[model samples]
Target chain A: MEEILSKLYYMTAFSSFTYQVAIMWFIAFLLLYLGIKKEYEPLLLVPIAFGVLLANFPGGEMGVVAAENIALEGGRYKNLFEIAHDHGIMNFLYYGLIKTGFLPPVIFMGVGALTDFGPMLRNLKLAMFGAAAQIGIFAVLLAAVLLGFTLKEAASLGIIGGADGPTAIYTTIKLAPHLLGPIAIAAYSYMALVPVIIPLVANLLMTKKEFEINMRQMDKEFPAKHTIKNIKAVKIIFPIVLGSVTAIFVPSSVPLLGMLLFGNLVKEIGVNTLRLSSAASGGIMNAATIFLGLTVGATMTSEVFLSPKTLGIIVGGFIAFAISIAGGIVAVKIYNLFAKKKINPLVGATGLSAVPMASRVANEMALKYDSTNHILQYCMASNISGVIGSAVAAGVLISFLS
Target chain B: MELFNEAVSIMIVGMLTVFFILFLIVGIGNLIIKLSNKYLPEEVVPVKATISSEPSNNTYAAIKAAIDIATKGKAQVTNITKL
Candidate 1:
């Protein structure tokens, strides 16, 4: 009877409970609440939070072991079969898909399929603000390095400023895979908070007059001399041309950018490549996101995540977010100083890779100032360019650090 | 100090490269638009003629009556022409 009781207690995980495990559980539950109750990036957060729960189940042995831990334990690297047999399925998925740095680019392909470059293509000048926003990445990199993180780790942490999850995850996977858990969480959390953050910074920097700067009125006053006659032809040609140019300059960015352009190409081809485009944006992308969220979340085991560095990352990420938004706004304000046709500072604020959310927030803010000022299209011009800009920035960081 | 220097260099190079690439895109994008406009301008779909003959007095009166009813006597049909 005594032996049986001991075995039952051991099997139930009650005997293995620790304060760290309990703390991880609390964090996981908080994320779950945020995901479900508040609808904060529910699709990703739900899976990730659930993954956290699974990883912290004490005796479950489901958490992903870091490569260094595995090497240190066994005095050598283990094969996939051995890893699966020893550590379970979570480790298998992590090492196989997430650690191999395969899923982020696949997700990027889907993003490209869903994206339309029409807005950016129409207002090409606004694309410069997208580049300006990338200043946050380097700024945070410097800060993180000063705070004692290695260059690679700092780069991973800094990329949270890009406001892109896949870009952050991809860079972290390449540079400092160990920091993947915290970096991804920070990136996605800040992205989900785009609505709150954009207004917070825009309100701080932009005046009522700047908010009321109507893009449509400006366009009527100074109409573009050259209008795209065959927009369809240009749309089809754009991905091809931009892909070649970007690849020529930043060859390291090919995996993420190349896949994105390929997906866009398939989408632009219309009915002919409809199947490929749908597959990329639908099933393939969904599956990749699930694996990515789960595997990445599983990496946030109690021992790995309960560090001073995680706190630093959380703080640094917010600074990065604020700085990126400010960089774009300041750039536009500087442009407004000289340019005859002034752009809404709100349009510049949307120059982060949070997609339609950033643009929508800017548009809503614009409408608040002037009912007739609908700047969604103009904001999209900068917002879409931001996606490309962040990816390029990620590539540069990868090339420099890794 | 070396790390700081490397970080600064990265900042300069990364920003410049991003700006340069996007600038090139803007230039090429304009070129593409110009070429397409010159060669493959949007095909103007010709509108088919709906009315080939003049309307009779009775037909014009009927149309005027319909408009007057729809507008509740607020509008008047001043002129009538046929294509």
Candidate 2:
């Protein structure tokens, strides 16, 4: 009887069963439900949910737990090998992929491969809406400062407004890795909720006339396809020029913008390197996303994630997202006041970097208001521009804050 | 107060910089479009030579059939000289 009791006591699982662990297990289940049942960004959420589950098992230590023994003498971070030896594979992945700031730039390269700059090029003026939408970042930054968070923390929290999960993750990793869990979760969750969030904001502000653009009626208004070869040449040169110009002014943006432009160049260059483009956009992207999601989720161990600051970040992020949508819509309305050939204001809501998702939401809303709107082409202009806008915002934050 | 001031500066500088960059992209992209259109103009397709459309078809078909029968379908009309 004594031997059996001792064995049970020695078992880490039996000894470590606490209410906090139970709550973490519940949180993991919640994430799984959101991913599997609701189908919200399941590609990311499912892997993240599994990582969360893997982390809470009492003695597993498969998560990126801090090295209690390794003391920071004077704010010096632990090197990769030191981190790996102390904390294991999850920590190694966290340090190598997340801390080294490698995954986000590579992910941007894949995004650039997937993107088409045609719509943005055709509707050049409309791309300004994408830049205007970034007001949410600064608005939230100010709000965070008023709430007593440090400038670095504010920057991380504010990037959630850009509506790009990877950019938010990249900024957080650079500014405040401690808040990575909450910030990443908020950014991705808001991105998935774009269909809901954008419409709610847009519906309140926009009128029926704003959603009324018929592609059939505008057949003659649109330009002919006489410049096809010219368009292709411009597409090839756009990334290289944009990357060089951005790096010249904002030197810190070079790493992220450089990779993004490189990816776009590979895709646009020609058919000779089609296989390379395919690998970057498809295989490598999916792999990086899985690793990034899992490691980010694994970092959300109970003690760090279940705090007042996490709650604050979640709330602040939502506010930022709502404001971004509003900012885009307002920008289009403002532009319409000055222009003779007015564009559908519904296209403005796509200014967030949720990509084609936000644009799709805008299109759906336009259809609801007027079935013949067909504003998708124009919306793509703003949507693609939003991707660049968010990257630029991330660059600015990093340049100024870091 | 200091944090608030920094946040203000970041907001102003960041928004201005983004707008400037995107504006440059717009300007450069448009310029490229205009230059390409000017320099690499599309070739004008030459008009097809007309040969009294209806009469040519009927006469050519008859001549083709005659040659086919004359050679027991071994020889066919390969070319016709204006002379």
Can you give the TM-score per candidate against the true fold? 0.91, 0.88
lDDT of 2 by residue, A229-331 (tens): 5677788878888888888887777777788888888999879779989989999999999999889988888888889999999999999999888998999
Total clashing pairs in model 1: 0
Report the C-alpha lDDT of model 1 over A273-372, residue by residue, as the tens digit: 9999999999999999999998888999999999999999999999998999999999999999999999999888888889989999999999998999
TM-score of chain A of each: 0.98, 0.94
- In candidate 2, position A355 carries an lDDT of 86
Which ten contiguous residues of candidate 2 chain A have the minimum total lDDT? A219-228
| Chain B TM, per prediction | 0.58, 0.49
Q: In model 2, where do residues sit more than 4 Å from their true spots? A: A67-77, A213-229, B40-83
- Model 1 interface DockQ: 0.48
DockQ of each: 0.48, 0.38
Which residue segments of model 1 deviate by more than 4 Å? A69-77, B44-83
